[model samples]
Target: MRIERSNWEQRTLGEFFDLQMGKTPSRKDLSLWEDGDTPWVSISDMKESRYISDTKEHLPYQTIAECRIPIIPVGTVIMSFKLTIGKTCIVSKPLTTNEAIMAFYPKKGIEVNSSFLAYALSALKWKGNRAVKGVTINKKTISEKNFSLPPIGLQDNIAAELDAIQEVIDGYKDQIADLDALAQSIFLETFGDPISNPKGWKTELISKFGRIVTGNTPSRAISDYYNSQDIEWIKTDNIVKDLLTPTTAYEYLSFEGAKKGRIVKSGSILICCIAGSLQSIGRCCLTDRSLAFNQQINAIECDVNHIPLFVYCLIKASQQLLIDTASTGMKHILSKSDLSSICLPVPPLELQQQFANKIASIEQQKDLLRQQLADAEMLMAERMQYYFS
Candidate 1:
C-alpha cells in the first residue's frame, strides 16, 4: 500500500521496483571469457560514474549467453549490496555486475522516474544487519524501508538541480585526473617510457638502490603488544595511491612489538604485497611519517641514492609488472625476491631531482583542486539532504 504524504506518495522500495541480483561467471571455465564489448562490472568500476557504461573487464557476448549472466539494460538503478553499501548508479548503458551488486528495475506499469530515484537511493541508509566485516542488504531488509516519491514533474525539476551540482563535482575530478596525467608526462619527458627505453637511459636492478623489508605483527595472544605508544601500525588497507588521503587506524606498540616488524624512517615507500583481492596487489603508498606495517606489506627505503618521490614514481611505474609477477595461488603475494628481480632506468640524480621538483609544484596545484572538489562534494551532500530529508 502506498502511503499518501502531503506532497509525495510513499512506497516501500521493493513495492516500486523489481530487484535483479548480479551474477559472476565460473572462473574454472576459460572458454566463457574472451575480449569483447560487454562491460563486466564490479563495485570498483562505478567509482567515478553517475551512469555506468565502461568497466575494467569486458565480457564477450557469448560469455553472457553461455553463462546466463543477466546483462542489465540501460536506465536501471544499481546499488552495491555487499562489502560496500549504498553506492548507487543508474546504468546509462548495458552492463553486468558481480554478485555483490543488485539492480532495481522499475516494475510493470510503475512510473517511478530513474533520475530522481538514483539520487534518492544513495541517501537511503540500510539500518539492519551490518556486521563488523561488511554490510549486507537483502530483499526483506529493503522491502521494509519507506521511499518518498514526488510526482514526475517535480522529480524532473529536482533531478535538474542535482545534475547541475554534479557537474561542478565532475569538473573538479577531471582536473585532478589531468594533474596526475601531467606528473606522468613530466616523468616520461625526463626519463622516457620505462618499458621502451626510447632515450637510451641506463637500467639498474632495484636491488642495487634499496633494501626491501617485510613487516610482521606481534603475537595477537599478547594483548599488551598492541596497546603501547609511539608507533603507528600500517595495514594493507592503509595503503593508497592518492597522497592526499590520510592512513589512520593506529595500532600502537612498544619495543617488544616493534622488534617483530620492519620500521623505517619517514618518507619510505610502501607496497601492498599481500591482498585478498587482486585489484589491490602492487598498489603503492608513500609514508609521510615513520610507521610499522604487518606481513601483508613490504617497505623500501633508499636514503642514499634515490629521491623518495622519484623512487615512488619508479615503483609506481612498475606496478603492472609487479602485479603480473605476484603469486596468485591463494592470496595475491608479491614476494621480496620478486620485487628485487625488477629493474628500472636510473636517470641521473640531477634529472631525478628536477622531476621531483616538478612533482612538488604539481602537488600544490592538486591540493587546491582537492579543496575545490571537497567544496563541490559538500554542495552535493547538502542537495541530497535538502531533497531527501
Candidate 2:
C-alpha cells in the first residue's frame, strides 16, 4: 500500500477545502440547549471514533440560527484545532460543533476523499500555543498546513488500507474493555453493591484501613531539590484509573528533594485529591514502588487486615461519593479529613482475597491485550508516517 509521494501535488489545506470553524451558543441560555435533537459536536465527542454518529450534547435548530454556527454536512471532515489538537473525524450526519473544531469542505469544483482527509489531518504534527487546558492551534496556521494529495483512486486505496489496520486496533481495544467490564462484574457479584451494602458487610471510615498521607511537592526554590533525577516523583497526571499500577513519572526529584516530599511506600493506594476538573479529583491508582508525589494526591498504606488492591477498587467504586463530597469552587479539593471520613464496606478477609485473585487474573489478560494494542498502534503510526509525513 506504500506508494511514492514524490509525484503527488504538494498543497496547502486551504487550496482544496473551504475551512469553517464552529461556535457554541451561550451556555447560560438553557433555551438554546434543552428540548433539542440536533447533534452538537465537541472535542470529547471526537475521541476514539473515526466517524461521529452521535454527540454527547445537542442543540435546537433555532439555536443554530441564533448562534450563527454552520451546520456541517454529512461526510465532511472535522478536526479539533484548539486545545487537544489534531483529533479528526468524519461527521456521519449534519451537525454543529464547538469553536475548537474546524470543518473542511471540498472547495468549489474540487473533489476530495473525506476518509483520506480525516486520516491525513489526524497524522498532522501540530505546533500550538500551550495554555491551561493544553495546546491551541490557530485557524490561519491550520489552513496553511500542507499535505500531498494523490489521485482519487489512490486516495481510496490508501484509506481502505488504513481502515483495515484501524479495525484491528479497535478490535483489541474492545477486548480490553471487555476484560475491564468482566472485572467490574466479578467485583459486584462477589461483594454486592458497595453503596447499598446488599450483603450486610460491615462498613467503616476509610481511615480505619490504613495510614493516610497527603503528598507534597518538594520546594522548587531549592535548586538542589530538583537539579538531579534521583527518584521517581508521582504527579496527579501519573495516576490512571484504568491501571492498578501507576505510570512512570514525567519528572523526577533529587535525593535531597525526596526528603522534602513524603515517600509513599510500595503497595500503597494513591488518589487524586485536587484538580481543576471535578471528574479528575477522584481518579485513583496503586503505587508499585516507593516514590515522592505532589500535594494533589493522597496515599494510603493499608494495614495488615486490608488488601491494597481491594481498598483501591473500593475507592474506585466510591468515586461518586468523593466527587459529591469535594468542595465546589475554582478547584475541586478532597481534604484529607473528607477523604478519611468516607465509609466503605469491609467484607471478610477471605472474601477480599478471593475477589483479589479474580481481579488479578483479569488484569493479566488486560496486560496481554494492552501489549497487543501497543504493537498495533506502532504499526499504525509507522504507516501514517510513511503515507503522510
Candidate 3:
C-alpha cells in the first residue's frame, strides 16, 4: 500500500497526547510497598525495542494510591526521559513508571499509534543533556519538551506497516536466540557438565593458556582525552550482546587515553571483571585494533596454539558457572584470582579449528538474518516517514 506524504498533517506531540510524568514514592514508607500487585517500571526495564509488559519490581495498591502515580494503560507510549534519553516503548499492560519515564495517552480523536510513536521517538534527535537537572536527571521532565507528530490516520497506516515488519524482525530475533541456545546445548552435551569438562581432554587453568592484563581508566576530569572517534573503548554495557566482531556502541578515546590505559591489542579477548556486569564475566570480543578499556574489564591475550574464537566460545559456555561462583551481595564481582582459576578443555588444534569453522558458519547465518531484520526495520522507518511526512 503506497501512502502519499502530502496526505499527512502535522501537530506537536503535546497537541496529540496528554503527557504524564511519574513520581517516586518515599523509600522510607515500607508499609506502602508490602505485597504490591501494581507493575512498577523503571528505566532499567525499558528495552530499546518492543513494549515492556513485565518489570523486575512491583508496588502495592497502597503505594500507588499514596504516590498518586498514574497507571498508564496498554498501548500507551512510554519513553525514557533521563539517563537513557529518547528510547521509547509501548505499555503492553497497565503499569506505573518511575520519574525516569514519561507516559503518553492519546487525546480523544487524535488516536496516536503506540508503535508509530515508539519508532518516532527512537528516531528523535533528542538533546538529552539539555534535560539534566540538579543531582539526579529525570526523563519524565524531559519528555514534556515539545516534539511534532504526524496526522492520526497516516500514523495508524504507517504503524500498521511497521508492525508487520516488526513481526519479521521479531521472528529473526527468536531464531537467533534459539540458535544461540542450540549452540550452548551442543557445547554442554559435547563437554558434559561445565564444571567437570567431562570429555577428560587436557584441562588447564586460564592463566596457563593466556596472559591476563588488567585495564585502567584515565581521569574523567580531563575532557580533552576523549574523542568522538580515535580508538574503540570497550565497557561492561557493551558485553551484553553477541559480537562476531569488535564494536563499541559509544564514543572512542584519544591516543593519549589509549596510552593511559593498557593498550588492548587486536584479537585479545576482553572480559568484564566488575560487579554490575558479573553476568558478563566471560563475554569476549576480538578487537579490530589496539583500544582502551576501563578498570572493570581485562584483556586476555591467547597463546599461538589456541584460537581466539574457540577460547571465547569455551568461556561463553562457562559463563553461568562463573556467575554462580560469583561473590554474593548487592553486587556480584569476579576477581582476578577467580578468573585465573577457570579451567577449560583443551581440544586438539585440528578439532578446535573444525569447531571454530562450524560455529563460524552458524554465526554467519545468524548475521545474515540479523541484517535482513535490520533492513526490514529501516524500510519500515523510511516508509513511515514517507507516509506521514
Candidate 4:
C-alpha cells in the first residue's frame, strides 16, 4: 500500500523528541566508575548501519547520579553528532552515551518508531553550518532537525518491514563470515603448520615469482595535486575485510603525482605495511590501470603466467600466518623476509584454474545478494522520505 505524502503530518525533531547529550564521569574517581550500573555507550558502540544491543563500557549507579546524565530509555534514536556525523542507530535498551553522542527520546503522545527515526537520520546528508574542529573537548552539535511523521500504526509497519530487510542482510553478512572461516580452515587443512606445506609442494621465495615494488606518497605540500577526478590512489584505509574492489578512497593525485610515486600497473597486488591497522594486511586488488600508493603500501607485480586471483587467495589464506610471524611491537610489521618465506600448495595450473572458476561463481552469488541488500536499503530510504518529507 502506498501512502501519500499529504496524509502525513510534519514536525521539527526538537518538538517531537527530547534531545540529550551525555557527559563523561571523572576518570580520577575510580570508585564511582566501579559501582555504576548504567550501560555507558561510546561512539565505537554505535555501528553506523547495525543494530546496537550492548555497549562496550558500563557506568556505576553512583556515577549516573553524580554526573546527572539522563538515562536514555530503550527505543531511543542515537546518533554520532561529532567526529562521524550522520551515522545513527536505535538503542535496544536503556543506555547512557558518551559526550560525543546525542540521543533522541520521543516525547509522550509523540509516537515515532525508533527504527524509522534511525533510518531517516541515516538517509539524511547532514552538512552542519559550523566547522567542527577537535579543539574543544566533548564538543557536539545537536541541532533541531525536522522530519515527517506518519500515524503510529504506519510507523510500526515501516519499522517492521525494515527490520525484516535488515535480517536478510544480516544473514548474508553471517554467511560471508562463515565462508571466510571455511576458506581459512581449508587452507590450514591442506597445508600443515606455518613452515610446512603438507602437500609437499616445492617452495619458492616470493621474489622468484614476482617483483616487489614499494610505494611512496607524493608530497602533500602541493595542494593542487589533489583532485577528485585524478587517478585512483589506493590507501590502507580503503582495505575492508573480504573487499576485492575498492569503491572509495581519500585524496586522488594527478598523473604527475602518479609518475613521481612510480605508478603501479593494473593487476598489481597491494599490501599495507602500516601500523595503525596492522591486522588489515592483504588488500590484493587488480587495479583497472596504473595508480599511486602511499609509502606504507607494498605492491607486488606478479608474473602473467601465474593467476592474480590465485595469488590473492593464497595471501588471504596465509594472512594469519603472516600475522603470526609479524614483529611484536605497538605495530605488527611484516618484513620482506617474512613475506618471502610464506608458501602455498602449488597445484597444477588446470587445478588452480578449476578452483578459481568455482570461487568466482560463489563470489558472483555473494555480489548478487549484496546488491539485493543495497536495493532493499534504498527502498527503505525512499519510503522514509515519502512518509517524513
Candidate 5:
C-alpha cells in the first residue's frame, strides 16, 4: 500500500471541481412525471457499487426543466453527503439526484478523472453529525474537505489498481450468490416447492413441530440492563440475507437484560416477523448460539421430529406467502399468531436430514468464499487509507 506521497498535493474538493447539490422535483405535479424518462439517483441506488447506470426512479424530461433541476452529465462523480454520507459513484448517463447527493465534475481546464475522484470520495473519512440512520454533512462542510491529489497519470494508475481489487471482491460476491442459489436449488430438487407441495408431502402448521416465542426489547431506561455485554442481543438487522447465523451485533445485554428478554438456544430458527417493508417479513436465519432478541423477531425451537435447518429452508422457500400475509395486514408485520398458523410441507425426517447434509456441503464452500471476500475487503480498506486518508 506504499505510495509516493512527496509529489502529491493536498487540495480542497471545492478547489478542483465545480460542485452542485442536487434537488428533488415537486412530487405533486402529475403532469411533470407523466412521461418519465430521465434517471433520478438516490442513496439506496449506490449500495456497494462503484458505478450507477440506472436508478430506481425516473422523471420525465420536461420535469427537469420545469423543476429547475441541474442535469448531471455522464462521467460526473456523485457522492451522498447527508444521511448516508460518502457513498460515491460515477454516473454512467445523464441524471439528476435528490438533495442528499452532491455532484462533482472537473472545472474548465482541469484534467480530473471521474473514476479516481469517485474512489477518493468513497475512501474519504467523512466528518459530520451522526444520527440514528447515518451521518449528515452540509454542502459547505463537504466541499471544504481536503484529499491528496496525485499527478493525473498517478491517479489513473491508482484507480486501475483499485479497480482490479474491486473486480476480485465482486467475483467473490458472485460466487457466494451462486452458492446461495445452489442451496435453494438443492432444496427444491429434494422436496419440490414447499409452497405448492408439488411432491404431495404432508403439510402442517409451523407450531406443530416446535414452540414459538416472540422476542422483546429490554427497557431502555433501565441502565442496569445494558451495563455489561454478558449476552448477545439479536436484532432484525443482524439477520443477514443467505447467512444462516447472525452477524456481529452492535448492541449487547447484561445478565439483567437477558432475564428481561427471551433467549432462544442454538439450532432454534429466528424469523423477522415485524419490519418496515413486506420484503423483510419472512427473512429467517438459524441461531448458531443462544441469544436474546428484540420483538421484531420470533424464534421457533424445533423438537426431535423436525430439523431446524430443514424448517428454515422450508420457511425461506415459502417467503412469498409470508409477504402476502404481511401485505394483507394493516401494517408490514406478521404477528406470532400469523407465524404459528402458516403451513409448510412436512417431508420425512430422513429426507429432511438428506437435504440438510447437501446444504451443509454447499455452506462449507460458501464459508471459504466468505473468508476470501473478507480478506479482499480488508485489503481494500488498507489501500484506501494509504492512498486517501
Candidate 6:
C-alpha cells in the first residue's frame, strides 16, 4: 500500500534495517540461566508497552557469552513473531530475547528515527497479522513490507508530533488509574483489607449477602430463540472490568429464548463462571438494563442490606481469588456454589453506600477523561495517516 508520495521515498523494512530473532538456551542447560545480570526478554514482558525496560526472566552474562546470544543495545525495535504475533516495543535498556521475538535495527549508515519506526511498525501490525501459526513472518514477507521515509529531520519532527499526542493520552490513562487507586485506598481505610480484616468488621460469605443465579442457553435447534431485538443476552465476553453497556450484549434473544435463560434486571451483578481464558473467569459487571445470559455466566442479586456497587467493587478486587478456585483444563469454570462461598468483609450498609457515592463521582470524572483521550487518539491517527499511512 502506498502511504505517501510527496517528498517521500518508499523503503522496504529489510532495506532500512536487519531482522534478527532472539534465542533461548536448552532446557537441560541449567548453567545458562540463573547464572547472570542480562535481561532475557519474552512476550510476557512486552505488555502493551511502547518501551520495555525490564524482563520477566534474566540470563547470566556468562550464558549470553557462552551461548553466543547477541544482545541488542538500547533503542533497538523489537517485535514478537510467534504465539503472540504483532506485539512490538522499543528497548530503553540492553536485553536479550527468545526466538519468538525479532529485533530490528537500522542498517549501517541508515539514520531511521526510533519513535517513527515504532509507530510505523504499529501500522504494519494491523496488516501483517495473519492466520499462520509458529512462524508468523518469513524473511520474504518481512522484507516486502514498505515504510515511507522522509529525511532524518522530517522523521524526527513526525516522531515528536506523534510522541506529544501519545504523552497526553498516557497522562489521561495515569489519571484514570489514580482515580481507581483512590477508591481502593478508601476501601482499605474504611473496611480494612478483606484478607486481614484489620478493621475488625464482620466477615461473611458472598452468598450471605446475595442470591446467586446461573443462566442457561436456549436450544440452538430453535431458530426463533435468537436474533430478536426484544431481549439482551449476555455472555462471558459481554462484560469487561466494571462496565456493562448494551454494545457488549450483541446477541439478542426472543421472548421464548429468555424463558430458557436467566433474565436479570438492572443493578444485577454479572460474573463470568466459564471461559477459556482464566484471567476472565471472575470478571464482573453491573447491568444498567434487563438482560438474559447463557449458562457460561451467573448473576447476583444482592440483599437489601448490600449495595450492588459496593458488591461490584468487592468482587472486582477479588478477581484473582475467584480465578484460583476455577477448575482448569480446556475451559476454566467456577460453579455457582463455589462463587457463593467466596468471603468478603461485610461493612455496614451506610459505609458501603458512602463508598458507592464516591465511586459514582469518580466514574463521572473518568468518563470525561476517557472522552478527551478518545479525541486525541483520533487526531493522532489522522496525523499518522497523513505522514505514513
Go through the candidates in order and give each one's C-alpha lDDT.
0.81, 0.87, 0.73, 0.68, 0.86, 0.82
Worst 10 residues of 4 by lDDT: 134-143
Q: Which residue pairs clash within candidate 1?
A: none
Worst window of 10 by summed lDDT in candidate 3:
134-143
What C-alpha RMSD separates each model from the true structure? 4.3, 2.3, 5.0, 4.8, 2.6, 2.6
- Per-residue lDDT for 182 in model 4? 60
Which 10-residue span in candidate 6 carries the lowest summed lDDT?
126-135
Using lDDT as the measure, name the better of candidate 1 and candidate 2: 2
Each prediction's TM-score against the native? 0.81, 0.92, 0.75, 0.74, 0.91, 0.90
Number of the candidate with higher TM-score, 2 or 4 = 2
State the lDDT of candidate 4 residue by residue for 96-193, as single tens digits. Answer: 88887888878888878778788777666555554456322222224455567778787788778777877776776777666666655654564443
Instruction: For candidate 4, list the clashing residue pairs, or say none.
Output: 35-60, 36-59, 36-60, 36-61, 37-60, 37-61, 148-388
Q: What does candidate 6 score on TM?
A: 0.90
Indicate whether candidate 3 or candidate 6 has the larger lDDT.
Answer: 6
Scored by TM-score, the top model is 2
lDDT of 5 by residue, 191-214 (tens): 998888888999999889798989
Report the alpha-carbon TM-score of model 3 versus the true structure: 0.75
Please estimate how well model 6 matches the true structure, expressed as its whole-model Cα lDDT: 0.82
Question: lDDT value for candidate 5?
Answer: 0.86
The lDDT, on a scale of 0 to 1, for candidate 2 is 0.87
* lDDT value, residue 276 of candidate 5: 80
Show model 5 residue runs off by greater than 4 Å. 1-3, 129-135, 219-230, 251-257, 327-331
Of 1 and 5, the candidate ranking higher by lDDT: 5
Model 2: what TM-score?
0.92
* Candidate 4 ranges beyond 4 A from true positions: 1-7, 28-38, 48-50, 60-70, 124-143, 192-205, 217-232, 248-257, 260-267, 281-292, 304-307, 320-358
Clashes of 3: 4
